[model samples]
Target: MLLKEYRDYFKTELLPVYDEKEIDSFFYITLEAFHQMKRVDLVLKPDFELDGMQLLQWETVLHQLKEEKPIQYIFEETEFFGLPFYVNENVLIPRPETEELVEWIINSVPEIAGDRKIKILDIGTGSGCIAVSLAKNLPEAEVFAIDVSEKALEVARRNARQNEASVTFWHQDILNTDILSETFDIIVSNPPYVRNLEKQEIAKNVLDFEPHLALFVEDHDPLLFYRKITQLATKNLNRNGLLFFEINQYLGKEMEDLLQEYAFENIELRKDIYENDRMTKAVRKSYS
Candidate 1:
C-alpha cells in the first residue's frame, strides 16, 4: 500500500479511539518506528510503500492502541537525554516531568566535569531513567541506583548496561533498610507520590496500563515515600550534600514544610515547564 493510503488507514482505524492530535502523533511515530524512518521521511517520500508484512505490523500496534495500551509499552523503548532505554509494564515509561527533574538536578548541582569524582544516589530508580541520564551527563559522578522490585531492578540494570552509563544497581527497598552505608554528594528521587485521591485524575492510559506500585500512595499518607527517602538522605548524605525530589504538584508547601522540619537548609521549590510546583532541592548543614 502507498504511504498516503497507509496514513489514511491509520487516521480511519485510530480515529474512533484517539482524537486528531493523538492520532497524528501515534500514526507518525508508529510508522517511523516500523520503517526505521521519521516524520520528515514521510513528508519527503509521500509515495513510500508499506509491504504486506509491514502493514500487518502497523495493524497490530493499532489494535493494541484501541485497547488503550500505551504506545511506548507497545514499542518497549524510548529516548531520554539522547540515550536509548528499554521499558516494560514492570517499570513506568519515563516522562517529560522526570526529564525536567533530571535537568534540574544536572543544572543545580555541582557536577565535577573534569577529574573530580562525585557520588550520586538515585532512590527508587524506575527504568533507571534518572540514574542513566545523570551518568551519561556527569561523566565524573559515580551513580548508584536502588529499587525495591527485583524485576524493576533487572530492567534498570539492563538500561544502565544498554546506555553504557556505569550505574550501580541495587535491589533494596529504600524504606525498609539503609544498605547504602556510604555517603553521597547528591541523593535524588521521583518516588510514588500520587495519592489515592488523585488516582482518578490520572488518565486512563496510565491508570490502567502503568504499574500501580510505582505510581501511588494512600490518600491518608501521601508523603510516605518522600518522608522515608528524605530521612534516608539525612543519614546517608554527605556534609554539604544536596537532596532532590520530584514531588506531587499539590504537595509543594507540605514538602517544603517537611524539609524545613528536618533542619535542611536553603530549601528551594521549583516549577516544571507547566508551572506546576514539581521539583525540590535542599541541603544538609555544612560541617567544617
Candidate 2:
C-alpha cells in the first residue's frame, strides 16, 4: 500500500483511542521503524510502499494503539535527555519532567564535572535515564545506579552500552540497603511519590500501562522514598555535596521540610514548565 494511504488508514483506525495528532505521529514513527528509513526518507520518496508482511505488522501496532498502549512501549525505545533508551513494561518511560530533573543535576554539579572522578549515585534509576544522561554529560564522574528490578537493570545496562555511557548498575532495594558506603558529590532520585489517595488524578493510560512499583506511595506516607533516600544522602553525601529529587508536586513543602531537618542547606524548590513544584536541590553543609 502507498505510504499516504497507510497513514490515513492507521490514523483513522486509531482515532477512537488517540487524538489525530498522536495517531499521525505514531503512524509516521511506526512506518519508519518498519521500513528502517527516516521521516525525511519518506518525504523524499512518497512512492515508498509497504509489503503485505510490513502492512500486517503495522496493523498490529495500530491495534495496540487502539487499546491505549503507549507508543514508547510499543517501540521498545525512547529518547531521554537526547540519549536513546530501550524501555518496556519493566521500566517507566522517561518523561520530560524527569529530563528537567536530570538537567538540574547536571547544572548544579558543573564544578564536579572537570574533576576526573566525582562520585554520583542515582537511586531508583529505572531505565537508567538519569544515570545515563549524567554519565554522558559529566564524563569525568563515576556514575552508579541502583534499582530493585533486575529486569529494569538489564534494560538500563543495555541503554548505557547503546549510548556509550559508562555506568555501574546495582540491583539493590534502596529501602533495605546500606551498602552504599562511599560519599558522593551528587545524589539524585525520581522515586515513587504518587500517593494512593490522589491516584484518581492519574490518567488511565499511565495507571494501566506504566509500572506501578515505580509510581506509587501509600497515602499516609507519601514521602516514603524521599524519606528513605534523604536518610542515605545525609549519611553518604560528601561535604558541600548536592541532593536532588523529582518530587510529587503536592509534596514540595513536605520535601523541603524533610531536607531542612537533615540540615541540608542551600535548599531550593523549583517548578517544572507546568508551574508545579516538581523538583528540589539542596546542599549538605561542606567542611571538607
Candidate 3:
C-alpha cells in the first residue's frame, strides 16, 4: 500500500482509540521501525509503498497498538538520555521526569573536583537508564546498579553494554539489605512509588501493559522504598554525599518528611518540566 494511503488508513483505524497527535506519532514510529522510512521520505514520495511482508508487520503492530500496548514495548527499545535502551515487560519504561533527575546529577558534578573519582549506586535500577546515563556522561563515576528482579537486571546489563557505559549490576533487593559493602559518593533511585490508589491516574496503556512489580507499592505504605533506601544511604554513603530520587508526584511532602526523619540534610524537592513535583535530593550531612 502507498504511504499516504496507509497513513490515512492508520488515522481512520486508530483515531477512535487515540487522539490525532498520538495517532500521528504511532504512524511515524511504526513506519520508521518496520519500513525504515522517515517522515521526510514519505512527504517527498507520497507513493512510497509497503511490500506484502512489510504490510503484515504493520498490521501486527497496529493491532497491538489498538489493544493499548506501549509502542516502546512493542518495539522492544526506547531512547533515554539520547542513548538507545532495550526495554520489555521485565523492565519499566524510562520516563522524561527521570531524565530530569539525571540532568540534575550531571549538572551538580561541576562543583566536585574533576580529579576525585566518585562512586555512585542506583537502587531499584529497572532498565539501568539512570545508571548507564550517568556512567556515559560522567566517565569518572564508578557506577553500580541493583534491582530485585534478575530479569530486569538482564535488560539493564545489556543497556549498559550497548551504551558503552561500564556499570556494575547487582541482583540484590534493596528492601532486605541494610548496608552496602562499599561506600558511595552518590546514591540515586527511581523506585516503585506509584501507590495502588494512584493507579487510577495512570493511563490504560501503562496500567494494563507496564510491569506492575516495578511501578507500584501498597497504598498504605507508599514511601516503603524511600524509607528503606534512605536508611541504607545513611550507612552506605560517604559523609556529605548526595542522594537523589525520582519521586511520585503526589508524595512530595511525604518524601521530604521521610528524608527529614532520616536526618538527611539539605533536602530539595524539584519539579519536572510539567511543573509537577517529581524529584528530590538530600545530602548525608558531614561531621568533623
Candidate 4:
C-alpha cells in the first residue's frame, strides 16, 4: 500500500485514542524508526510504498498506541539532550523539563583553568540522562550516577556506554545511605517527587508504563528524596558546591525552605518552558 494511505490508516486507527497532532507525531516518528523515511520523504515520494512485513510492524505499533503505551517504550529508545538513549519500563522516560534542568546545570558549571576536573554526582539517575549529558557536554567533569534499582542502573549504564559518555554508575539506595563516598563540586537529583495523590494528574501512558520507583513519594512526606539529598549534599559537597533538583511543581516554596533551613545559599528556583517551578539550584555555604 502507498505510504500516505498507510499514514491515513494509522491516523484513523488511533484517532479515537489520540488527537490529530499526536497521531501525526507518532506516524512521523515510527516512519523514521521503521523505514528511515522522514515527513519530507513522504511528500517528495508520494508513490512510496510499504512492503507486507513493514505494514505488520506499523499495525503492531498502532495496537500499542491504542492501549496508550508510550512510543519511547514501544521502540525501547529515545533522544535525550540531543543524544540517543535506550529506555524501557525500568526507567522513567526522560522529559523535556528534565532537559531544561540539565541545561541549567551545564550552563552553571564554572570553567576551571588547567586540569582541575569538576566532580558531579547524580542521585537516582534513572536513565543516567543528566550524568551522561553532562559528561558529553562538559568533557572535563568526572560524572557519577547512582540508582537503587539495579534494573534501572542497567539501562543507565547502557545509555552511558551508548553515548560514549564516561560516567561511573553506582547501585545504592540513597535514603538508606548516611553519607556519600566522595565530595562533589555539583550534586543533582531528579528523584521521586510525585505524590500518590498526584497520580490522577499524570497521563495514563506514564501512570501505566513508567517506573513508579523513579516517580513517586509518599503524600504525607512529598519532600522525602529532596530532604535526604540535601542532607547528603551538606556533608559531601565541597564548600560553595552546587546542589540542583528537578522538583515537583507543586512544592517549590517548600523546597526553597528546605534548602534555606539547611543554610544553603544563593537558592534560585527556575521554571521550565511551561513556567512551572520545575528546577532549583543552591550553593553550599562556605564554612570558615
Best by lDDT: 4
* Candidate 3 residue 49 C-alpha distance from true site, Å: 2.3
List the lowest-lDDT window of 10 residues for candidate 1. Answer: 108-117
Query: Is 2 or 4 the stronger prediction by lDDT?
Result: 4
TM-score of each: 0.93, 0.94, 0.97, 0.96
- Number of clashing pairs per prediction, in order: 0, 1, 0, 0
CA lDDT of every candidate: 0.87, 0.88, 0.90, 0.92
Q: Tens-digit lDDT track for model 3 on 249-280? A: 88899999999988888999999999999999
Among all windows of 10 consecutive residues in model 2, the one with the lowest summed lDDT is 108-117
lDDT of 1 by residue, 1-288 (tens): 997787887889878788999998888788778787887888888788888898899889988998889988999998877788899999999888889889888896653233558899999998999999999998878999999999899989999889888999888877788546788989999999999888779988899999999999999999999889878777888877889999999999999999988889899999988999999999888542
Q: What is the lDDT of residue 74 in candidate 4?
A: 98
Candidates in order: C-alpha RMSD to true structure: 2.2, 2.0, 1.4, 1.5
Q: How far does residue 183 in candidate 1 sit from its true spot (Å)? A: 0.9
After TM-score superposition, what is the CA distance of residue 65 in candidate 3 from its true location, in Å? 0.5
User: Residue 164 lDDT in model 2?
Assistant: 96
lDDT of 1: 0.87
lDDT for model 3, on a 0 to 1 scale? 0.90
lDDT by residue (37-80, candidate 4, tens digit) is 89899999999888999889999999999999999999999999
